[model samples]
Target: MTQKRLTPTQFRNQLLAVMDKKHHWAWPQFAGSAISKAQLKIHFQQEYGVYVRDFPVLLARIHGTNPPMDVRRKLAENIFEEDTGKLSLGKSHPELFLTMMAGLGFQNGAFGNLTLLPASRRYRTWLDQATLNRIWLVGTAVMTIFVEGSINDRQELLHPSKARSKREIESHIKRHPLVRFHGLSPAYMDLSRAHQLVENGHRHDAYDMVVNHTTTRQDQETILTALRKSLRLWLVYRDGIARACRLTP
Candidate 1:
């Protein structure tokens, strides 16, 4: 029996359903309240090693698969901004992250050599294989939809950042835990600023690439399975970080 292919909208809804669960219980502790500098350093180190540092390379792995012209173009644009930040800021996202960390008194070298927690390494190892999967759509969905798309993805798609004024944006950035608690000054928040600037189009582009370019029922199922795995692994990964941070939740 032939399976019915899902419409782009339907597949996207399912993907968003998975993303909605991206939140960890301890996230509120980490984001909403204050934590020690040690805790914050540990958390950001795991994060940098896991994804922040090599995200562009991960995207490039997907692009190297050569899925389609449109897909390639979208991936290229994402890679360009993440690696160069030319379209938004003048530094790479990872560099900007280190700059933000500097405001918290973390040296750039602090992020250069760090060990991943057990669960963190497990999740990262999965990313290694998944992003290099033979079926490009599996890699694409895992990275574009699951990795890049956040829990607020639905809101991002519906409202977009254009609705927010620059003041409103800066206000939100000022409220970040790093700024409010760790004393990371808003002046060093160019990473957050860069995200706000480029994210309006990038979020929509990520959805368009995954939702519209997918062409098969099998590919649809494959992508969904990959995303589900990503969600599970990511949850465990976040749990490990929370434990490292001595967070109860």
Candidate 2:
């Protein structure tokens, strides 16, 4: 008998389990005092070459391109509210990206030259094909469910003060003009609060549960593959907008 395909939620849960397990192993390899605000700022300026303040404009430019109405509208709202409003902490400190990038050790110029990772490339290529073929909703699913969902997770992790020095970080983020506007949005706040609940529930020790439940190398690979697929789907999302705008050469 053929096995039943998992629902999206079920699939996501499985993927999270794998990530949680990986996080335990990966965290130690990457963690250090080097993941500091000052280092993050230096890394961002030298490597990414784009400040957090500029992110909204980039997003706006992409969103402004004519696309399917729903996709355009969602991107517009998310970009505007995120870049301009209370959540706009990204714009204010600009260093947050540095902090994040530093944590991931993604500062190498070599990384910039790459279009996408092996897993992400396939997913993006698929999305581009789907979008060009007019499978618009499929493209949107790649964006809203996976790409945006990942950002939401990262934001939740960063927002709450896990460190004793969180107040310093919060102050820097809060003082930014864009972040001020971000906080004003009720929808954004609501979504943030909900995500916070999830993050809070997943204690560091929860990795034990994740490992025990997943139980096998095959299961671990399956979850990793799914995450990679989701990331690739996000590239399709970006390209879809580009296509809609007739921006692609």
Candidate 3:
């Protein structure tokens, strides 16, 4: 039997629903915990550096002939901001957070390496391929729509809680000069900014992948499955980070 095809919007909405559910289940477990925050900061610091280093490579892939000039420029700007911001974090925070994690008896390779898990590796690989193929808009959708939305939903889940957890969160947020300075507040704010920018049609070039492609039932299903798997994997990573930090109940 042939499967019915979904529009891009339909595929996106289905992925969003799955991400929302996972975020609801995972955020509260980590948000307020001091240990969790510490671990998260460490994780973020590691990922941030790796992302910065790879930004140029990702850009090179996107800049090849045949990609729309406007799309290339917009993605270049986004990558610049992201990488430069992260570089600033590394400069200010002298403590090598990932190295510290390794010292703490965490799985040295898994926690130390930026793209340790299958999901993360898949997400990065997809981004590279999408950019190289000049389908970056689809890549942007996956990152901003699905990934950022998932993070925002998780942050919302962390909103209410009074305990050592809450205190720890407050303290970390207050003390981390880098977070406030760099505008790394709750994940919602980041995602919201990206969503608004996309909605305003500022970066339609990035969305060209999904827009120009010939739609088919199989394509729609494949995209949807990739999105769902990416989200679920990240959620699991969040949970593992929390457990590693001893934040789980």
Candidate 4:
């Protein structure tokens, strides 16, 4: 008998389920513990070393593989926003992130000397290998769908203990908790504003790109395999950071 294959909806849901479980938000260090600004720097530095920088270039690598025109268009748009921040705030996401770092009192150039932890380096290596060596659809799924989509976007916007109206919730979400709780100034939260503006339908875009482009069962399986590897490596990466932060369960 032949192996059973999933429909596009099933494939999309399977990918989404993987994302739901694999989010870095589940990391214990991010769970509202009162970490000092120094700890936050460590966390951000690890993140920047692996994925925050050169993310657009990774997306462009997939886009340049000559995928279907529709997928290429979407990928191009995503790359444009990432590279130039033309869609959201006037500054690029990387630039916005650096601004936040500055607000934390680090010099603008501190991120330059940042080094990756062992697990973080491994994760970055896998990402580079997958995006560069695998099929374009697999690269797209791993880079755009798995990396960019988040299950907790809405949940993160909610206050942990407050029962507020939608308006109140939205207002509170405008400023990142990093600014309010982490001793960082709100003046450098352009990254938060950029996310609020452009992230509403990003998850759907990731799924749709993978689903629409991957009509064959083999391609869907390939994408799923890449995502599974992504999730596994990602968990280890977070564990490395969490342990470095001395976070307790």
Candidate 4 residue-wise lDDT, 34-120, digit = tens: 776777778889888788888888888888788889889989988888889999777778888888888878776779977799999
Residue 42's lDDT within candidate 3 is 50
Tens-place lDDT per residue, model 3, 131-162, is 45444444555554454344333333335222
- Give the best candidate by TM-score: 1
The parts of candidate 3 lying over 4 Å away from their true place are 1-4, 22-26, 33-41, 49-70, 84-138, 151-214
Give the per-residue lDDT digits (tens) of candidate 1, residues 1-249.
999999888988988899888888988887765678888889899989999999999989989988889999888988999999998888999999999889889998899888999999999998999988988788888888788878998888877767457898899998888888777789999998988887777777877887887889888888888899999999999999998888895
- Tell how far residue 224 is off in model 2, in angstroms: 9.7
Off by over 4 Å in 4: 24-28, 31-33, 153-170, 173-175
- Each prediction's TM-score against the native? 0.95, 0.34, 0.51, 0.88
Q: Model 4 residue 232 lDDT?
A: 91
Clashing pairs in 3: 137-206, 137-207
Which candidate would rank higher by lDDT, 3 or 4? 4
Once fitted onto the true fold, the runs of candidate 1 whose alpha carbons sit more than 4 angstroms away are 163-165
The models' CA-based lDDT, in order, is 0.87, 0.39, 0.46, 0.76
Give candidate 1's TM-score. Answer: 0.95
Clashing pairs in 1: none
Score residue 167 of candidate 2 by CA lDDT.
52
Question: Quick one: best lDDT, which candidate?
Answer: 1
